[model samples]
Target: MSEPREITYAQAVREALRQAMQRDPQVFLLGEDIGVYGGAFGVTDGLLDEFGSERVRDTPLSEAVIAGTAIGAAVTGMRPVAEIQFMDFITLAMEQLVLQAAKMRYMFGGKARVPMVLRTPAGSGTGAAAQHSESLEAWFVHVPGLKVVMPSTPYDAKGLLLAAIADDNPVIFIEHKLLYKTKGFVPEEYYTLPLATSEIKRKGKDLTLIATSVLVARALEAATQLAQEGIEIEIIDPRTLKPLDTAAMIQSVCKTGKALVVHEAPMTGGFGGEIVAQLCASEAFDFLDAPIRRLAGLDVPIPYNRELEKRAVPQVADIVREARALVRGEY
Candidate 1:
């Protein structure tokens, strides 16, 4: 094992892409401004010079074409990693992703595979307005064929991304805009983490906090604050949204007897709803001492004003307040 070094989340993603592309000659990248411009958030920076334009490709400002091209390449035996500048633009490429890439393998009776990755930055905090700052993972999860992954830390960001690239299916890899520059320790050697595994980040006996992406960090912060007041929260990060590790979540809920799902996506149709529904259907529902509450983004378009945007999503204080109430049976 190599010594771990601190690196930003964006750096970890770049390292994963570099390692994957180097290890597989068939793997190539295509996206708008990803070549010399180095990506919208600089996650793909410097790759064009290292691998040249052939592998590190730059396309015109057309997400539909970028996605369609990747799907075609994947079906033809190429592992193309495409980037949608922001998740908001994915709507333009929905046909290619939902209709084609997601159904190719089953449609062709396992004779064809779409081993492609669609990486995009999501979530608010940079005040990029409603269009650019939406947490739309639930949209992909609703589709039967796509694998949804949201990595909160640099370590998981690197490992899970490598796994997504290797999988012979379309993977919707979401990176929170605020998490990109956040630093964490990452091993120098290449590694892969299971895409279906959910990790219990912090163990507690009182309540369970299931969080995704940027909310994971906020939940952990809230956990620290609540610890001082005697409220113990077990934090579970479903690193992979689809193919979710329901067993891990169920076990945590069974032990704690209360659960609260937190995410930046709106409450009405967020991924948290699916988690709650699964828990309700499972035997974990019997173990609950109180209702499983969800602390999520407001059911409205994300606001462009910094203060209003912050209000739209769950915050550290919101988690602390909600956890306190849930544990006390006040919610």
Candidate 2:
């Protein structure tokens, strides 16, 4: 087997789209500024030239239309990968996504399939402010039919994306805006990672830290710092949020006897709460030496000021502090 190659998260996603389109003629892309303009973040850059205008389409500035069109194509036996400019904009198409795309398969009694992928950039870092930088993944995870995926590294970004496109259900594939240029080792070959599986990125026996999206990277950094102080933190990244890998998480928490859930989303109504609740209700509850804690973003609009924005979300130091408190029985 060949060695894995290093590439940016954005490049990995582009490669997945290219390979999927090449392998299946039924696969096509449609979204605002996705064609000649190469998408808002350039993830779809250069595809228009290779696949032509018919396949790499540029649609109107209507999120509802883009989502509606993708659903229509998917039900008609076409694989449509639609892009929402930013996650915040997805609210405009919630009716189409939550009501139509999510309920199609069940409403049709498994006779219909919506093999479509809705890719959107989420989270805040580049100062896009409140309207452009929301991480509302919990909303989709609440829906029954939609599958939610938030891949952190370049490897999972490509692999999980391929799996999402191949699934016979509507997938909400969320990409973090700050992670676009982050580099990591990714296989050059076409590969797919299981959707509902969680990955233990780092192994430890001291404490279990379950982080999602951009927080995964931050948690790893904090782990490095804590390791120097003789505190080993086992980090688990739940790449797929909807169908969480609860068994894996339960096992980790049981072994460590302490757990901390982290995310960039607001603390109130965040996905972290679900993770904590799952741990509390599971057999892991008996094994817990401390209360399952959540370290998440402040429940406020993402600030425009740089420092304020930084304070809004959990930083590396914040993770380290929280982990120390949990391990030392200070929480």
lDDT of the candidates, in the order given: 0.95, 0.95
Using alpha carbons, what is the TM-score of model 1?
0.99
User: 1-331 in candidate 1: lDDT tens per residue?
Assistant: 8899999999999999999998999999999999999999999999999999999999998989999999999989999999999999999999989998888888888898899999999999988888999889999999988999999999999999999999999999999989999999999898999999999989999999999999999999999999999999999999999889899899999999999999999999889999999999998999999999999999989898878989999999999999999999999
Per-residue lDDT over 287-327 for candidate 2, one digit per residue giving the tens place of the 0 to 100 score: 99998899999999999999999999999999999999999
- What's the TM-score of every candidate structure? 0.99, 0.99
Backbone atom clashes (below 3 Å) for every candidate: 0, 0
Assess the local accuracy of residue 249 in candidate 2 as a C-alpha lDDT between 0 and 100.
92
Q: Which stretches of candidate 2 lie over 4 Å from their true place?
A: none
Worst 10 residues of 1 by lDDT: 101-110
